[model samples]
Target: MNVTITTIYDELRGFLDDHQVSTNETILEQHSKDESYHTPSLPDIVVFPETPEQVSAIVKVADKYNTPIVPFGIGSSLEGHVIPYDKGISIDFSLMNKVLEVREKDFLVKVQPGVTRNQLNKELKKYGLFFTVDPGADATLGGMAATNASGTTSVKYGVMRDQVRNLEVVLPDGEIMHTGNLAQKSSSGYNLNSLIVGSEGTLGCITELTLRVYGIPEHIAAARAAFPTVDDAVEAVVSILQAGIPIARVELVDEHSITQVNRFSETDYKEKPTLFLEFHGNEQGLNHDIEFTKEIVEDHGCKEVHFEEDNAARNKLWEARHNLAYAYMHLNPGKKHMVTDVCVPITELAGAIKFARKRIEELGLLGGILGHVGDGNYHTSLMIDMDDPEEMKRAAQFNEEIVEYALERGGTCTGEHGVGIGKMKYQQREHGKAFSVMEKIKLALDPNEIMNPNKLVHSKRRSL
Candidate 1:
């Protein structure tokens, strides 16, 4: 028997303390969508749980009612991971924000799922340590783990999956379980930690995360190298990685993005395809690496290469890169951003990006290309009027074409973003038989299909 929305709301209100449950339309609408172009679906109710027991109790209540429960953190996901499409309950984790422990000696930090990256970093700074996975936004650590997020530093520090030492999960059935222990390495049975990391909240809700941290590097330097063409800049990245330069971050911002950055940042960067690169190590090591990188970039037809030695200048350089998405938004004031992510082998990156640029031009879309090129991942941010059907259709076609191209080249549809609602159609094509295995796991874990249903896996659309 399906419970009515009013009944569920009343039950939730009865179980929670003041400020724990809300049925206000404005708050419900706020929890309905993420930062994507997907249509928003308002949940009937929103609830915040401050402890693992509370989270488990809420899940149990939803299970009894056979109502959908969507776990949300900061609502910063670029895909539709947090959307409560079935008009059920949205479990916001904001109240659970806490940094429980910081094991400085062991290089690990334990935090509640609601803790944002910036919040954790602030506490880690006193210990001279930092977390590596930065997903552009100051998103929650749990959301980062959910999407297996990777960012500018991924080429060196790896993604969210790599940094996670353990996870405390509240399963769909309200069963509390530990994915793994704090051992540095394990040769145990199945890798549940990894399975839950990128499951997009379909398998379970992460309550606490024990993450690996890094010590502050001895020396750091930032550089900007402008190339005659995007192809040249991509090739330079390939050469740098092939030569084993331990670059902390290597991002590519195309000519269009450079123009947007100039407008948004109030700085005059050359309006050309450029590589924003950073190196971290001892002074001698960084100098040697920079020298080698300069030679490689110049060989690839770099027009201008400048290094920033001052800390303020280096921060300014990365701040510009981090703000590229907002810059695109600023440049196109009235349109929504439709970003596409595809990752290929390093050798094939230049060709893929070149093809994307030509395709964007052919489609007559106003967009810019920029991403962490060192990891063979790139994104094209397009500004589109969401209300215009023709423009939306064209954007969909463009995304499909790019994903198909990447798959044809043995690449992935998404490098950092998981298979949320937007990427669902490509899963079967991307994973084939393995896709069935994923569905089977989903059934085993969430038989009622209550945990973020219609996401990551395809199921018949059901009405609330």
Candidate 2:
């Protein structure tokens, strides 16, 4: 017995506002998919909840109906975490966007789940404070927390989990709970806050987040260093880290990505394996750091190093880096992008990149390699036509081989993107005996398997 939109609407009508529930095909179709390459399954309905109470009520109703509930942010997830694969309700929190409080004195900000990093930064600019975990997209704070996302800045500031101090969650049984306090750190039993930060909405819906903020640095400088080989760039990053240079951002872009960036951003940068880097500190400190970094990079065979001091030029440089994925999409119009993320130990990063590059070339795929090198994590963005089964197969094979390589080298299959549908097969391989423990936790939190069902875990559907 398949659950229908009419059934859900009838059950939720009394508890929600008239306009909050949507059954329109256009809206449902729009919410059905994310930025990933996974196949989409249209949800029976979409609902926008504005408050924790309302979200709890919605969860209760869905639980009663045994309908899967997926928490949706901006749908910027690269792992298909936001896609409604089993056909349920996509609870969109866009309307709940609100920055409730900014405690400058304590260096923390409390915000509603729908608040995005860009949006929060706009507000924090007045206080000379900023949040640093940027995942390329202006993704919602809730989504970032769901995926434990990190990007270029994560090399210095850490990922979403690092910034999140507390979470107000609505559990599957409609119970509201606070995961942590506003304190800086704690020895408290069981770090539930850490557990829920990357739960991917299978455990609960995040209604509010208490995030740590940072004061804007007095000095900032951006630099681009081109290398003769990708291995040289990776080795340079490792040397920089080992030398204890406080790099604010260290991103690796292979020759393929530089080519796409050149075509898309209309900038004539050398098409070579490069590291787009940045540093933030006092002027004197940054100067010394940059000088030391330059020396280390030169020793590693750096071909050219260009530094940008002006704010506008620096922003433009990063803008090009952020647009690399979009550029690949534009270059391969009418095709889907398949990105595989894997992280290895710093010493092994160069070897891993070399192997992946050889494999990608052997498979004959149009893709580029890029990532936050400071963290020893990288992603290969493959442009594949969904209509071509052969292309999809080759992409999957490439992803599997790279993940296997990483796992064998004591690394994770995914560094930032959560295990949605794309990386589910590797969970067992990566977690080993611990994977069973994860399933037990899932069963305990969501016995009915109604919260984002068939995601992050493999389980059989209970008969109604």
Candidate 3:
């Protein structure tokens, strides 16, 4: 152990219990990596801080020592956002998980950053409220906010940044600040809440969040529509939106993904490019929307369409879609998963997916194309044999091609995964001159570059 880290470890015990601080190999290894395919590096120490005060003290110590600080959540992030590449102090937030408040009438909830989406939902159910911004994974709200994640319902409810009302962040120098307040609208000076929510811990550590929630839908319906081709399915979605159908969720599952879903879920769904859709409204309005949706899909050559009216059936259908990544992992044993998260304008969605599918076939790689097409975001789920140099190279090439296509057509390199090293290379091209502004902001907020170094933005001071 290095002298500096060893001293910091000893000093941390003064503020936390002996068991709260850990140097054991198992704990270090757990905090080293997330769900990404990126290589993992162990942090020098892992600390469990129960309160924001302890978090501030830990950051103060790290700042004094010029040590890198990486916040660890549940490690469910897909873009390596939680990996401690600099090997310093890993602050695990599991010990601080708690739903601090629920203002049911105001439709706002205050929660510690460590609380998971499902965990919060369970609590919100008591008041007939639910948090939106689900990123498929039961990711910690902090990690979701860090990545600015969004998923199926994003077309209707918006992304993580939209749901976030306020954030209690601990800055790099251990000073705590609140980025926003509970008011519904604000013309306030700077929207720091938006800035910190998707910083990926580069700017600060999110200790608490005040988020907006919604009442449970009065009428919910899930429907699956099979199409002859990917283009047809996507066209249907665009048409639905244009027709003013307020879709709660509309996901596109290509034939490859459908096959995986069938095998993994033990269902007899047709192996065709399909659209999984949902609607929320009063019973009469929802019925009309469903009928209109069927007509629109039929106009675009939909082969068959069916709806799930009950909660159990709807949940099961969505569960299958959410588990699609796991299905690929399960089928491709001994392989690592890397998903491309490029989002484009609604008009460019079909061409982008077509381009990605062609590249996957040209590279002779096994991958599936699927996404929340309702919001013009999709992913190419790739499974790679990391040991094979040729396979790794091809996978890298595919990702680069997909990202390039997205960037060329006015799309983002990363829609929700955050920069997280995987999409770091495309930042300059995607943001152009604005990329410099991001770097300046990072430096201004974290001059020492101790907050999750080597992520989202480049650091001027930190070499590693």
Q: Pick the candidate with the highest lDDT.
A: 3
Regions of candidate 1 where Cα sits further than 4 Å from its true position: 1-3, 460-464
Model 1 lDDT per residue over 1-464, tens place:
14577787777777798799988889999999999988999987899999999999889888888888889998888779899887788999998899999999999999999999999999999999989888889999989999999998999999999999999999999999999988899999899999999999998899999999999898999999999998899888888988999999999999998999999999799999999999989999999999999999999999799999789999999999999889989878889998888898888888888888888899888898987898889999999998889988888888998899999999999999877888888988999999999999999999988899888996554622
Worst 10 residues of 1 by lDDT: 455-464
Q: Which residue pairs collide, candidate 1?
A: none
Checking candidate 2 for backbone clashes, the offending pairs are none
What is the full ranking by lDDT, best candidate first? 3, 2, 1
Q: Against the true structure, whose TM-score is highest? A: 3
Candidate 2 vs candidate 3: which has greater TM-score?
3
lDDT of 3 at 58: 94
Residue-pair clashes per candidate, as listed?
0, 0, 0
Segments of candidate 2 deviating more than 4 angstroms:
1-5, 462-464
* Total clashing pairs in model 3: 0
In angstroms, give how far residue 251 of model 1 lies from its true place: 0.6
Q: What are the lDDT scores of the predictions, listed in order?
A: 0.90, 0.91, 0.91
lDDT of 3 by residue, 1-464 (tens): 87887899889988899889999999999998998898888999999999999999999999999999999889988778888877899999998899999999999999998999999999999999999887888899998999999988999999999999999999999999999999999998899988998899998899999999999989999999999998899889989999999999999998988999999999889999999999998999999999999999999999799999999999999999999999999999999998889999988999999899898999999989998898889998999999999999999999999889888889999888888888888889999999999999988888888998888877654443
TM-score of each: 0.98, 0.98, 0.99
